[model samples]
Target: MPSVVKWSHYALLAGFSAVLPVAAYAQTEVEAEAEPEAATTVTDERVVLEADIVYENSADNTIIAEGNVEALHQGRVLRADRLIYDRTTERARASGNVIITEADGSQQFAEEVDVGPDLTDGYAIGYSARLPGDATVAAKSAIRRSDGINALEHVVYTACPLCEEDTTPTWSIRARRAVLDEESQMISYRDAVIEIGGVPVFYLPYLSHPDPNSERRSGLLMPNAGLSSTLGAFYKQPYYWAVSDHSDITISPMVMQNVNPLLGVDFRKRFYSGAVKFETSFTHEADFDSDGETFGEETFRGHLYGNGLFAISPEWKWGFGVETQTDDLYDRRYDISGQGDKRGLYSNQPRRLLSQVFVTGQGDSYYTDAALLNFQGLRGEDDAARLPLVSPLAYADKYWDLGAYGFASVTASTAILTREVGADSHRASLGGDWNTMKILPGGFTFEPFAELRGDYYMLDEDVSGKDSVARAVGNTGAKLAYPMVRPGTNVDLMLEPAVMAAWGFSNVNDPAIPVEDSLLYEFDESSLFEANGFGNFDLYEGDGKVSAGLTARALWKNGTEVSTTVGRRWRSRADPAFDVASNLDGKSSDWLASASLKMGKKLELSSRVRLDEKDLSLSRFDMRAATSFDWFRAVGQYYKIDERISPAGTSDEGIFLRGEIQFTDRYSVVFGQLRDISRNVNTRQEIGIAYTDDCSRFELLYNRSELRDRTLGPTESFQVRFSLLSLGNFGSDSFE
Candidate 1:
């Protein structure tokens, strides 16, 4: 049985404080320079004393002392109501209220104790001890090995010093045996009963763990078990493999009644140059209803990924990543959804995975790039989206400086599509310029630029057998802005009036390419000048398009910054080059407006909108705001896309809000909600809270949505969570 102490017993132990005034002592030096096989000799160079001593000579040639005897040796001091010393044998024995103390602020007590001649080995029957901080332990019998090492038989250990009175912890373990090897700094236990509030919660045949001061140990991690309405009862046993100081692997085998046994693995390896990480899962059984049909399409899916960085030279380097996975229901059914929804859309056909490989070199003012691949999984209406098993194409480009007067760049690239609508397209462009110059009575600045572009396309028989087409285009533009300062509140204000006029001409026949990729063509800077600038450039006769637009902007700052922009555009004959519908009878006006504001250092707001001048219909509206304080933070965003275009789907609007609060250092909570305005419904709501204490912690989580439900509530659900995350003295292994 473990040692049990009463209140009076603790008071009695506290009474040992009367011995604190004893002289301090250092350790006796013992020469220990030999091989591992030799008997170690340790020396204690310091010893002190104070006491009422009674000595007795025994037939064993030992000298013993009794009656409130106290002495200090090495870094430890001992006290007892009675003690017997053996001078001839270099050993001592003590009984009746014996207490031992160490220099590091730890104390041990026992009813009867025996000390070794060299202080290297001893035994204390019915001993209890408290280490640094609030950690404490007790046992029916205890033995000291080397240094501060100890072993307790029938022991109980706890980091909560305040819980000393209860031998059977409310939520702790009672071990049949325990060993503390101080020299190696480790602890182990056998035949342990994991109890909670004096009740047995679990029983382990054998277990071992590291002490509070250790960082790594070879042991079994805590097992996890849970029940899900869909997955039934499940359990996961995880094992950790320490490959080295910087690398490790965790393999977890899952067992559940609703599905086949599953094996999940996470491997991490660190090299002198970089690191590599990978995770994968595999299973052998199906857990879905197939309308009573025979097992079809034997379930099989796994994920493998490896990415790292390498130093090519002093000023240049390269890195790449490959994220690939299988199983359409991998996220919804297995709880793997985190990155995006594209991976969670399950289909009977084999799903496609995207993979890309590219390299680029960067310098002070110029950069070069090249890539030999396809952006897999990007499906077009006419072709499948699966990744090609082999490399698709190669391309490269370069950019440079045209002195401080202006800048220019050139690009050339080609690609061969492999799908049914496949075609080989090549593009080459060269552009350069001149900037606006301001004549300042004092000091001023000016900026402007112009460019010329060209393109060539070759068609495959499967696409159109249209042979080929070549076109060239030119554009010229300029902008001038002046800063007007307001010295009233030290606020600098800038108001700029700018205009751009461009003329483009292109010769091509039969609208060279399709319109699959030209959706975002309107209101863009790059399309300012280019052959086939807009898809289906041949839809119009020889491109002789003239367009012009004027923009006004103002920037002002006092304690914070603010900016605004307003612009309008008009073109001759609704230039197809401007992506303006050729059917627009006469000249039409298009307008854009935007504004942003920031106050002090805590709050900010911004908004932008576009409209068609003819009908005055809202094109796009976006707004965002955020604020933070000592205890709370909140952020909100709104996005509205017109019916004209929305990526992948028709236009829709939505709003999202997120906030968090800190009650204390040990407690915090967070909340987030997403609402779809167009559908007049809530997308989702999430909330979570955490609380920590000296011995353990509790976590609560809840989420609600119409699409899916993980809890019992139709629109609301939550879960209670707890684990051994404390017991500070046991380091952080309590959670492992």
Candidate 2:
């Protein structure tokens, strides 16, 4: 049987307060940590008092309890060496090691306390309180009134832990007089002085903040200040408005020394089933170069980005995203980021952004998706007419379980692509596939699969040929693999040899149907044995081919692993649809090899390479490495491509590396670099030093960037940021 229980039931029993105080304290701690709604009124439950001696004087209507007195009511508890209650005045007082723990888990410790019969109002000497999240308040003395206000003298507040040897905390706030308003759950200090490293830094007449138990309250947030080569000295102050329980907005206005002021706004709202968020910024200024030199005509420049997702049903949902800008260099010049990081928003390249609306649904054995997509180019050389807009791109797939026999599945896809200056096209495709797997003797596996697909295309203009085009594609294949495992005391080894032979219709590539999604096809180890390597309806691998691969892996007992795979494909006839640089143009494809190594989680290295089959020369390679040392951690990636068969000036070689060197427990240095090896230029470089303590953090950063856009050319910046606990935080967009 299952039983339900609550700790309050146990708290109602006699003499149980001492045994359950710890449990009750834990419950309140969790509630405080979550910062739930504040309880305004005390519970009316009867107070259960336990003590060694209890006496009542009817004549004076006074009750006295001594010798380890304890009073419990719900989760709240009061403990002291002695307690006195005046029935006539409805007041209760305690002395000698008095401790009062509220229902919200806040604790107060004092030598003596006097209050009403209900203990709601009190006066205490040597008072100190511990709030949630390491925040504390101490005072020489305090007075509490029935109005739920506390007035304290000689108050000290801090969220940092104190060291016994040093005594001083990382940071502290000292005030001559402090007022705590329980009704508003706020603390206000008068004649306060801020101290850092035990040295007075700033003085304030008045300061107020929530009692660490409230969040999302409306107030002026922290300010961001920086100096940039483009914008010069800039400072932004942001104010947050808690419009309602379900919505909020932040308005940030930035003033710059070199240009006109800019305003940034962010709004968010939550619904029962979903949420929406948007951010935008606007500025009016003349065109400016990287040197902050103004030119051309003055104009309004800004950018708007937004995303939203909502649920329609249990198995269906829809979402939309949008990104737009008046010019190419606005975001970079203003240091804006966090765009294209939402659902339905896709950014394929560094300077290109995609806005989309999509609907998706899934069932036990079926899936479907439909989307409408648009593109925005942020590159200086981008031609808007050449961009593509795809509407009603849809796909659906369903499969059935065949148990003993071969399984079967059906898939359908359709797309409509339109461009301002290029041809408009529409394509629909339907395919059926059947496959099955069998385990044979000696740990051998064999599989057979067959697929037939038909695609119809309609073009508004000529596409190599004229008008509509239709093609029927079919492929049948059989794959065989033998995998073996050898377990040893020190290492475990595994090897697998796989081969596939597929016969399909040749010369099925129709020139009248243009390729959209399969323009950059590259055969690699991951697709070594696949019958069809192309991903779109227009281009399908329809020639007979044989592919083979060998994979080997070793795992050591000390959490080390190494793996390698090598594969190649042989085609009966050359496929003209693939370019030479793709490694799949000739009768024999390039040798595709990949290797990986992992020395536990702190280190990893992986590489993939393609070698020309004719000369056995390196064609292209991408390598990545990551490692963590005692004082440093770094990750690096490098890639190079052969220039012989690539587009003019497009063959590329580059490396990007970034990491942090932890020199101490509280300090570290971070750096990153992106170098264009072929061009002998550093595209981006950054270095920063960071420091953190229990109550504060400080950072200093420097960055340099060199880009192709004339308006966004070489620039450098240095930034500084610092934050303190309970005093809000301040930061800006990263240079990267």
Q: Which candidate is the best by lDDT?
A: 2
Alpha-carbon RMSD, each predicted model:
8.9, 7.7
**Model 1, 515-577: lDDT tens per residue?**
323434444323322222353222322333333333333344446777777766555444343
**CA lDDT of each candidate?**
0.53, 0.76
Off by over 4 Å in 2: 1-88, 93-107, 130-135, 140-143, 150-154, 175-194, 200-211, 340-342, 345-347, 462-465, 557-559, 628-630, 645-648, 723-728, 732-736
Error of 1 at 512 (Å): 2.4
| TM-score list, all predictions | 0.67, 0.85
Q: State, as a TM-score between 0 and 1, how close model 2 is to the true structure.
A: 0.85
- Model 1: which ten-residue window has the lowest total lDDT? 23-32
